[model samples]
Target: MSDEKNDKDRRGIQSVEVGGQLLRALAHHGHPMALKDLARAAGMAPAKAHPYLVSFGKLGLIEQDPASGRYGLGPLALQLGLIALQQTDPVRIATPMIAELAQRLGLTIGIAVWGTRGPTFVRLEESPAAIHVNMRHGTVASLTDTASGRLFGAYRPADEVRALFEQERLLGKLERPRLAPGTPAAPAPTSWKEFERALAEVRRHGMSRTEGAVVDGISAMSAPVFDHAGAMVLAVTAIGPSGALDTQWDGPVAQALRECADRITQRLGGRPPVPVRRAA
Candidate 1:
């Protein structure tokens, strides 16, 4: 019995491992594929791959489009992915990283998730030399007024974000406050078209920025964390005093935030969205 167990461990099933290549190929392509194309992508002959596809179809892991005869991930595959994401605690995965980032950058690091009301800060790591910023766990952010809020606004569904934005606007949440000392006053969007441009810029840069908008003398940058479905699930932001924090789009602090967000996304088996390109 011991010898049999050892043999099993040393030489796991090869057939199943080979079949996984087909699933991986489908995922990598990110679209439905013809049988021959899929087989080639999986590095197998069509005859060799068809059997596995049939088995996977029966298990509901992959489905064939009858009209086009293309194969794609099926309902069971989607369900499994969603279940995995549901069980994943993004905050738990991000806490230590944010703590380290705060210490390294000497800026307050925070994690925000889309809460019922708005972007809600769930975790915070205050730098030893951090200034007084009115933020903490459970603090809800303003959609048009904070980096984290704009990050979500940029990535979340348009209708939902718009509804919340209008709600906030009605409550006077969209008003831009007076700028902090020496902070340049960038105009906040006044119309829906202008708001879209702002969000598009956020998507283009893969981050968001705020200068004394949320709190006086405070500046911040935020980057998004996405899940495997290419949906944003969290936002990581860094905050510091206006002069102390560089707000350049590609500055060191912004780079660090983007990198940290990317790491967290990757840790959760997620993919970053492709950068939005300007019109040719």
Candidate 2:
């Protein structure tokens, strides 16, 4: 089966049993790196590691920073991330909560599990209010583009996350994080300070917002969801164009998102995932 093959390929690339070691190093380094740094920190020769990094990049599973040449996990890495979370009906478990969130906040809501390409909008619950702009089901948005992606992308592991930084060009890629016209461009977080600041806000607030991070006048925010076995960022999401919610309720909606995702973790019958420390 293709699934089995992707798994095998993934194991060969990551050696997941020991992959955490490489990820930890990336977290500490806190900047884009040249290939030399990846192997040194990963405890392997750059020559031996070069092929894998290149392979990962070719797969869009990882990328070399054009600005700095460091390799980090790509969007494909997030696609690979769901291997653990899909063990249960993660979407179903999050359903009632997401719907309640929709009803209460009067904004379209959903949960996006992280993947190599970015956050896949796996579920959507629209507000009953006739005024809502409809968001589609099964929409996949990039971590660089949407609130769902940011909530999840900002939380991805560093070794696996570096590739998620803004890419310079897309001449030979399998996918592109969906970009809407007129959205302000985000310079890839090229340093730990910037990456850490984003992650810190996500943690402290349990989410982040954009006036139009993805689309002009379209606002969104999200939280994180964990599965029982420590699959982090299982799903946390919210979205709407400007002026959808009562200004006062945005805070409560955010809290509800965090609370509901946490409760869903328990409902799904697994121990909550440990927070992977934000990369440097």
The best candidate in terms of lDDT? 1
- Residue range 57-112, candidate 1, lDDT tens digits: 99999999999999999999999888887898889999999999999999989899
What number of backbone clashes does candidate 1 have, counting pairs of residues 3 or more apart or in separate chains? 0
lDDT of 2 at 153: 59
Candidate 2: where are CA atoms >4 Å away? 1-87, 130-134, 166-193, 246-250, 270-280
Candidate 1: residue 169 Cα off by (Å): 1.5
Candidate 1: residue 22 Cα off by (Å) = 11
Can you list the residue pairs that collide in candidate 1? none
The true-structure Cα RMSD of candidate 2 reads: 17.2
lDDT of each: 0.86, 0.62
**Off by more than 4 A, model 1:** 1-83, 174-189, 273-280
TM-score of each: 0.67, 0.56
- Clash count list over all predictions: 0, 14
